[model samples]
Target: MPGSEHADRTEDGLSIPRHRVLVTGATGLLGRAVYKEFHNNKDWHALGTGHRRARPRFLRCDLLDEDAVKAVIRDFRPDVIVHCAAERRPHVVERNAEAAVDLNVKATATLAKEAAASKPGAFLIYISTDYVFDGRDPPYGEDDTPEPLNLYGKSKLDGEREALRHCPAVAILRVPVLYGEVEHVEESAVTALWDQVQEGAAGSCMLDHCQQRFPTEVRDVAVVCRALAERQRQDPSSVRGIFHYSAKEQMTKYEMAVAIAQAFHLPASHLMPLTEQPAGAGARRPLNAQLACCRLRQLGLDVQPRPFRTAITDCLWPFLPDKRWRQTVFF
Candidate 1:
């Protein structure tokens, strides 16, 4: 493994066991969470990649650059590659379809091919999205057919398909809204709202829509990735398929906003409830992005779902102000 350091030696001077891992998209929200979990573990030597700013040991390379990606794979010789880099913004993807396809689909395919050829037994875990499914119903499961409503989701789905062809040793993990604190910034939906509350921005409390799906915390999603990595390490040929990672329960956009407000001790009236309408500029969202984790549970990786209130509190507490804010804002 490239980044691994031998801790001890046998009588004959054989090195101790270690696993070297590489993570792409180390700067994004979920990617940062995964990096934090793996980077700090002693058993795993971690290398992270970013397109722009190089953070400490992180490598600077765009995923679209095939030669650069291949060089990193060959040099690092990682035991596992967690692919998270992508053009994630829906609106941006809609506007720049070529860029989105290049980054989200073509780059993923290239990484899978390079990883498989460079490190034959290495496991490749691709981070997917719940947006793949059109939210037509509540609590969609793994077996449920995907009907992506936007370019972002379709691109990710295409990436998943391309990855499977190039890398058989792969696990596709589809997750929902990830919220938490990392790198001193709040990136999740809940945290975004908390920032508004802290600033006494009444608009934060009121922009609720009826359409939304289950929300999963960043920490929980990290745990799932860790478990999947460990599983791959142990068996290498274990069940490989699509897995859903999200809070078990469902919630609407309006209800979710209200819960966040309550967690921050702000009045619900500050929130504005808006009718569920298709996103205008970007691609339309699936009405039911809720994912059923039954298959994931069957694999013995059943993640305990956190309640909405608990999730809200856990996400917003860090951003809560020391003093109380006004509760008379219009909903």
Candidate 2:
């Protein structure tokens, strides 16, 4: 069986079988990074699943459909299932709470059940959010009890429980706001600030300065996910239960805007900071939800994330409107 240790043999003296990995939400920002990490690694054969925007290298599957999820799991017979699909937008989740539950909790539950019932029992990793913490405290450890403030956070917490309920050998990774290579500037919340910066350059712009956020890079999170998969292959019992991964830098959205303006060589005099949550928001967010990464650090994985300024500059470079302006600023 492909799931077994002796599935494939190599020419080298120490032969290792290449495991098949199935990634969900391949088209999304973070999902794309995760799929790329595993797809590029020679140790694993990866197949990604997506909906609406599905294309080559990814199999189209609506996770909400139990039958479709079952078919993918049964046919792919993955040794590892990385569940990254979810209604991640807090406002969107608020608009239709039912739909959020369906995708976040119900769909995750279905995937976990199918993975557990597979012939070899695929190890499942459910990507979660740091929003599970209420943000009242700093450096939340793995064992810390979650106290989510909004529907999105609550739903993700519930998804974690459901995934664990159906699959005992599940690993839950809770990450914070992520930014990385984007198809467009608005694809990621961090990169999206570039638009606001540009708008602020035109006139005054108000940004959230009260809530402290640790914006992590999607590529960094992808690396950690790959490391966990590799650890599971080496020792099935080594990677299980709840874990946390995040960047160490701390800054508010207002500060982030300032950084973005500086990075792109734009004016920030028009930018304003709102120390309180914006009025009429769809949902209430935590003031700070810093996740402690003691576990991953102890596991010998890279816990130090790239500097925010360096990463954000690289991430927004591709979307720069004027090629000559980009050359003038960067060069």
Candidate 3:
């Protein structure tokens, strides 16, 4: 309830009364942000779950295990369940299809069904990805038909379908690359680059790939999720379907690298450019995965209008002091 007063004054406002909420994937980057956003609300009781380590109120739970998930649903009886857990590495999913299915698709389906049965009016928000599209087009809207190119996208699409089928009140939020600071492993793109520069490597830069994308910051997504959760509590019949949430501007990976270098006063010359090519023998990536957020804005969500450079700089502020870097190179 720390930011409740401000959170309550949003467009949809706090429509639902006080109730307990459950946040899965509480230890992940975006999940941690969401947990922080809702943790202090006096009106709503916030309980979270992590796969291994215990967060403040988090209970140990592996979402892939249906019995464990069902037990959480029965015990917590949350009014709102925000599902942010998933196996996101594309090649990893490609290599281990069954684990991906078990965790991303099966676990999500289990949670959705249990939430629907346990709490009739509960709202279930599934965090999905913009990679669900084939990326033939540059900017994709909410209603645009998805043509997923890989196993990761296929599995998430499957989860989305399952959520819609079982949960009457569900919000499938498709977001793009989530960047933020949590642990060393959870550092943002900007942070990763800054670490490289601090390590005395010629500052790093991405190749001039034509690929464009709408990157969603971890904090911003958390804010929207909390807002939507409140709205669902207020009006169960409001609306239900896919919602795109991301920064308004589209930025190429190279442009993003330049911005990160500038944030720390590094010379652009220090950054190297690499062409688009397969890393090792993995899946080919989409050249353009930008998302359109008009529907979310129409619904009164605050979409940041600045360019991605500004957003990247903001996300990099906290991690500059760490001064660490990864030697693994990618284009």
Candidate 4:
């Protein structure tokens, strides 16, 4: 295979076959990063699927359709399947419980079944969330038992179960709040605070001192996913099972707002910290979701995530070329 050094060589010792990788939800925030990572890498042929948004590089596939999922796997015959499609919005899941169940759990189950039958060495990589931990503890390890707080977390936990049940040797990456260059910052929870800090606008930020979290970069998560795929090609056994990946430092929403305002040169005086819960919230969240990554580093993946302060530029990226503190409006 393209990822393996043991492949048959040509006259000059160049491998002929290339690794095939399929990434679902290609147009989404994190999915876009993962697909781009595989596409830019020369050793793999990356194919991605999209739903509402269509493009030449993307294959339009509705994950909810079991037949569509089967057709894509059978035709592409991918060596690795990165399942990233899910109904992630907490309030949306609360309102549309059936839709969440169909997409988050049922679709994942469909993909796992197809991947298992397609090839013996086919690897199923499911992207999970740290919300599986009810934020009651700190620095949760890989073996920590999950106690989700809301529907979104519950759905993801159910997805994990389905993935493991169908594809016994699946690799799961449970991550925290991800921020990266996307169509809109709202795709990420923490980065979306930039929107709230509008010019001369006053807003109340929750004094969520008890609820601690880390904002991980989507690009960083993508790097780890690609590394796992490469390692799987070499030794499938090593990459199997659940793995945790997140930012190095954890901060509460209140603390993060202060830093975010400083980075964007916004006023914190108006962004008052309120101890009471924010109004119109349908779901309860984990108070502390800090993912531990010691095991991932031990695997020799060479994935060292950037610090929150240094990665601020990475979160805004090409949109705001000059990352210095500037009084500017970000949509």
Looking at candidate 3, the ten consecutive residues that score lowest on lDDT are: 322-331
List per-prediction Cα lDDT, in the order shown: 0.76, 0.89, 0.74, 0.81
Write the residue-wise lDDT of candidate 4 on 158-186 in tens digits.
99999999996589999998878767767
TM-score of 4: 0.88
Kindly report which residue stretches of model 1 are placed more than 4 angstroms away from their true locations once superposed. 1-17, 182-186, 195-205, 278-281, 306-331
What are the per-residue Cα lDDT tens digits for candidate 1 across 215-288?
77766787788888888777767758788888865666677766776765666765567775745635687766
User: Per-residue error at 55 for model 3, in Å?
Assistant: 5.6
lDDT (10s digit) by residue, model 3, range 243-330: 9887765666556666666655655665555565545547555677778877677778755544655666656655555334211111
Compute the lDDT of residue 109 as modeled in candidate 2. 95
Kindly indicate the candidate among 1 and 2 with the higher lDDT: 2
Best by TM-score: 2
* TM-score of model 2 vs. true structure: 0.94
> Which residue runs of candidate 2 sit more than 4 Å off their true CA positions?
1-17
Spell out the clash pairs found in candidate 3.
Answer: 1-40, 1-41, 1-42, 2-40, 207-274
Instruction: List the candidate 3 regions with Cα displacement exceeding 4 Å.
Output: 1-17, 55-57, 185-190, 195-208, 278-281, 305-318, 321-331
Collision pairs in model 2 = none
lDDT of 1: 0.76
